[model samples]
Target: MSQARPDHLTWRHRLVALAMGLSLLVLVVRMVELQVVNHERYIEQAADTRASGAATLTAPRGAILDATGYPLAISIDTWDIYIDRYVWAQDPDAASGAAIALAGMLGLDADQLMASGTSDDRGDILVQRRLPYERGAAIEEADLWGIRSLPSSIRSYPEGDLAGPLIGYVGLDNEGLWGVESDFDHLLRGQPGWVLHERDAVGRPIAFGQHAERAPEPGGEVQLTIDRFIQDIVERHLREALLEYQSSSGSILVMDPYTGAILAMASMPAVDLSAVGTDGAPEGEALAGSVRNRALTDLYEPGSVFKTITTAAALDLGLVNAESGYEDTGVAEVGGYAIRNWDFQAYGWVTVREYLQRSLNTGSVWLSQLIGAENFYDYVERFGFGEPTHIGLSGEAEGMIRTPEDQDWYPVDLATNSYGQGMAATPLQVLTAINSFANGGLLMRPYIVSRVVTNDEVRSYEPVEVRRVVSPATARTMANLMRDVVEGVEWHGARVDGYTVAGKTGTTIVSIPTGYDFDTTIASFAGFLPYERPAVSVLVKIDQPGGDVNLGGQVAAPVFAGVAADIMEYLDIPPSEQLVAGQ
Candidate 1:
């Protein structure tokens, strides 16, 4: 028998029992709260862990249209076929059958598709890309296991290869790769949406499972300043010029002088949008060679075409007048270098009009000397040389100009630069600079896209005037001088039947890493038509004409005439009475 327990010990035992009961009560209350109050939260958490899948809803890329609202580049509904690897791994036999069925239906390699689906890494495997909408819909309706179809699109050019380089193309992911596509990709590619759905063990979307989706927003419509008819005419004339002149390559640009709108731009060896990625399409270096918009990318000496700038500067500064006389000894000596005229003949005591008509290099050197280096370079910079025009295009080059501040600068450079040698400029830059004359001495920034239309609003772009390079009087005088140059019998090739063309011809020797290629020349012409009220400013350049006759007036001038004449007629521009009277 045990002795009677102490009172203190008994109380302690009772207290311990009370603490245990209280702890148990607290636990039961917490369990009730978790199970009843927050039941749905836990349920959602568990479901999320079990099935999590999301997919992108591709947005249709924007359509690129011409000024007349004709589509140049568009996106057509398509589909991307994918294989769920984990689901396929779960059943090898099913995977093989699916691959064979897909191969027969969509023209794919069964063995390759099977291997891709059964690879060690488990994820979605892309089996085919850019399938037609109807075919993809049929595949989806068949309900093949582990096979998936995602909404997609393929870029289509309805006009075929008409403006391939200018409109550019998209890549496999629908990302822009060149030209307008690359430059304005942000506006062209719309925001993509997404979908969330309950998935199975292999992360494949479950049929009839809970689904939620956000609709994709389509891209905006880009309206370019380009005219389809004008582009066709320019391209036709450029191709013909290249063939007739036996030139390796060529480019043509037509711009509205008053508005600085690019009506048409064409480059040779252009990629055909319809044939890209096909069996016979250009690839690697060949594709790269053909894809560039040479008018804005390639740099070359403007030759005599640059003389327009020199003459304008001189007239603007009052350094020379149209009747100012100069002695042409066939050569002008500067910095121990002899600069001679194209014909290597002397015209004794010639006026400024005669010198320009003859395209005398000596006369250009004399005028540059009068304007001085500082003022001449200042004028050049004001006219937008040695810099990019920032014309919203990919791969636009900023041409090189040597100034007195540079280490390589020489005194002879002033003379050569005046005649458009010992320096370089893109064809677009040359045209833009000369366009100042037609625009009444105002230099306007060149642009391609005229407006962008979106679902919500339309943003129209206007002509941007940069600055005035010369006085209106000086511009009028220069225009008259240019008109005289084109009207001269020697440059008859540049004449239009019912138009007075104010123009200049350029024939530059191809400069190489080692000296120059004397056998080849870049023949070019820059001009504006209707003399009094200029409608279009045109530039035509042909590279490396074979055989004889590589002069700009002979090879490129005729091309300009053809393009300008057609454009004038298409635009319903009437023949000028001034031109007819002058003729």
Candidate 2:
């Protein structure tokens, strides 16, 4: 042993030997794992690990624009504020100040800000979400430790509640939640561009800038048929009616009858699109109770506006001539059920045209019986009842009609349906049904968007015709009669000067505690303008207008009138009837 000690190995030599042995052992184990034990698992893990450094692609969501290229909704650069609670805990006093200051800068409630204290379960707490650039900058200047700002985009509506339901807002994840925003999501959500970058073991950006970058793909733009000026006019009149009649809520819409392009769509008590949170309970009295698009989604009895379709159908089937006379006894009995006039006044020996003008229920029941139930049903389906126009918009309802096979088909159903009672349909459906008169008896698909544009190209959509429900002559005759209604009779209040106004009033009985036969009611109006040119159509609906006992003429007709007046003047349409006729 003493002789061997004379030739002892150096520390460097020993270290080399130990390192070689450990390397050999590691190689053997790795070889066994890769070749036999878990080869496939390792391979899959390797494949998945490649995504560790993969970049996230951001697709630019398309904007919604008005006829004048004003943005109803747009994506703007914003930031989200967060904090590492553990890091924040290292300095509690400073950390609490940072959170409070962030809340103040972002206009957050003090209690909500206090909830993100050091003891929060999330190691990292989100201090603020979707902070505007100025607010984010202000927070950054505060120089708070452990706080971070992440880049993002927000959907902003510049005009606030204008066309609120028609042009809906989006969520933080770039998903469309409602209305047009949800309808055209795929079209609005463009292909996302990405960055393929190299990251370290901890998934941090590499210092060498070793990455491949691709520019973001912005979504295509959507241009709607909505006219902002007309929309404003309609909103004003709707509000006026709400005040005068003390209604619960209301909606207004304008469309092109031939093309079926919606020009203006509005609902009262509209929520603020710019607000970060809309789903939660309202904080103030100014908040609107229901801002959903009532025109396209809410279903109700269409009243006399629906009468136009029935009258047209009867005339088209040759069951009744416009000059034909009906004996009106104030009430008509169907299956032993009596249907009376709204005012309980009899229209004795009234002509078909006069019945429509008076919106007499007895006359409509007579027309339905004369046309026959089977034939009347055929006309209703032909008029697009119980079916969505398939305008490619989200949340559109097909409405309700008792089919021949469906249950609850009482004889009274047919009788009451003749005068637009005991059946439900959306406003858009009603408008499209009315358009049968404007499109030469051919129905056009009701749609809101007129065009889609991209940086590379612009695409336009024309009016797509569905089918001919009646003869062109019948449509013309009906249009002429509708013109007479707005330009001459009870609905004369709905007329616009220098334009031929054609429309019908609807005072549907509410379906609440008191139903179709009860005293509670919803007031509404549906019409089309410039009867000759047939460029635009309008519909206005007011829910539960409790005062004045006004039908559609008092509450909704004025809205239709204001919108038509503004649009006709803007288009410079020649007066189809004199200004005196409207008055």
Candidate 3:
């Protein structure tokens, strides 16, 4: 009645009011969905915008030390530099200029770096790895846009290639790839840590951004039994001998017979640790062959070295004495095959002492026949043949020995094997077997790693005695016989001045797929010095020696004398006369 509005205007006002109410209801429902149902999802999306990520912090690898705690291989702190591709892509001109500056400082290609930054699908592009700490710090301080650096490390060999094959090398990712590095990788590569933090637009850590981090734990130190001085001595002599003999390759191993601790093991041709995987490094088959630690990996006929085991078994069983005599017509017919002395000279009758000194193949077969096939093979197994030495190195060969039980076994096989043919053994196996005589007939398990030092504790590896192969009386008698072999002869090549040497020489015709090579031979000597109080047992093997002088006494025994003399002097072990006088 006060203002009787038109009916049309009142209805229009009601519709407008309803539409406003519906719009208000829709706004409330949308707010509830975003704040409640999708709350965590939106938060994560927002985090993505702030460039939040967990950065890996690489832990430093451990050091490999020698017997006297000298570092052979180690890792030093460095830095890995990267460019934020996303940030670089946003500004091409700025990326180019920054790349040029970095390239100038780091000796990199400027154009290539820029191209990689822009075209790489990854958000972070690796510009450089293993930059020296000082250089990396300088780069970081410069704060160049789109560039970042993270702490890293690189494997370093202070002694260079001194023990390269044994110490091994690492890959670009800071992981051990060979030798002790590969064998003890778990202990060498410590646990890595990480940091969760927000980054700025250019992928740099934001000063005030939320952050959390866990410190990295460094790896434990590996202590090897190898003596650096002894290693150097062995390597020096071995190289000289290889060159003199014109040998294709060789191995020299020195061990502590009592403890079976490896003092020095050198195998040529050696791989240079620092130069491995570089521009001029060996590749494919050559690389594979170069990296091998041949002392334990390569197998060959033990030759007359196997005679030592046969004689020991016969003496232990009382089947033969040092004075036991055998008739030698220069050759013995066994199983329709003729076995002859190394010199192929007929000695109508020879004592056991002469058998070893002369290295007569017929004499070895005579002893084997007396010992019987079962007893001979038993001695072989007891001496740790046909098995690996388990010296804690990779690629060790388990040697091959066929017995009467095998289908290929024949009576002739026994005759040949008695003189170290029709069988195979590694240089390590030959040494360890001969080492039994020096250790009073006790077989000891050889080991390379002496100890491991960690932040929490120090673990030392003790000497392990596997078994006794003969009586101490038998061992003494054998030692005496071996001593006679060296000293009994006038001007013996194996004789060391002022030291009583006990040893055996071995020379084998190189076997091929068709048969033995008439032109090549493997010359070797296995021996120990100061026989009454043995300190070191050594094995020297020279493969495929050139020229006509390839006999063990001519080529290998002289090298042994030189090496043993130097080692005795270095260890301050008194001469044989002094030792005997003290006793």
State which candidate has the highest lDDT.
1
lDDT of 1 by residue, 1-583 (tens): 8998666767788999999999999999999888998865554555546533656778999999999999999999998888888778889999889989998898889898888888853567777788999999999887787898988888988888987888888988778888788888888889776666677766765789866666778998899999999999999998888888898888999999987899999999799887787998899988887888999999999999999899899999998899998888999999999888889899899888988888899999999999999999999999999999989887899999999999999999999999999999999999999999998999999999999988889999999999999999999999999999998656478899888889999999999999899888999999998897898999999998887799998888888899889988998777888546656
Off by over 4 Å in 3: 1-52, 89-104, 107-122, 198-210
Error of 3 at 479 (Å): 1.0
Error of 1 at 401 (Å): 1.0
Which of the numbered candidates is closest to the native, going by highest TM-score? 3
Cα lDDT of model 2 by residue, 1-583, tens digit: 3554475789999999999999999999999988899964554444346464443455768889887888888877666677755556667777677767776766776556555656652344666666787877776777776676655566777777787767876766688877788888877877755445455564454688455545667899999888787788777877887787888778887887878887788787676665537567354444434547777788899988888888888889887777898889999888888889988999689987888788888888888888887888999999899998897777778898885566779888888888888888998888888888877898888777888998788989888888889999899889877877777684367877667778889998887645454666788888787776777888888888886576888777876787778778776766765444664
- Residue 357 deviation, candidate 2, in Å? 1.4
Candidate 2 TM-score to native: 0.78
How many pairs of residues collide in model 1? 0
> TM-score-based ranking, best first?
3, 1, 2
Q: Which of 2 and 3 is the better model by TM-score?
A: 3
- Give per-candidate clash totals: 0, 1, 0
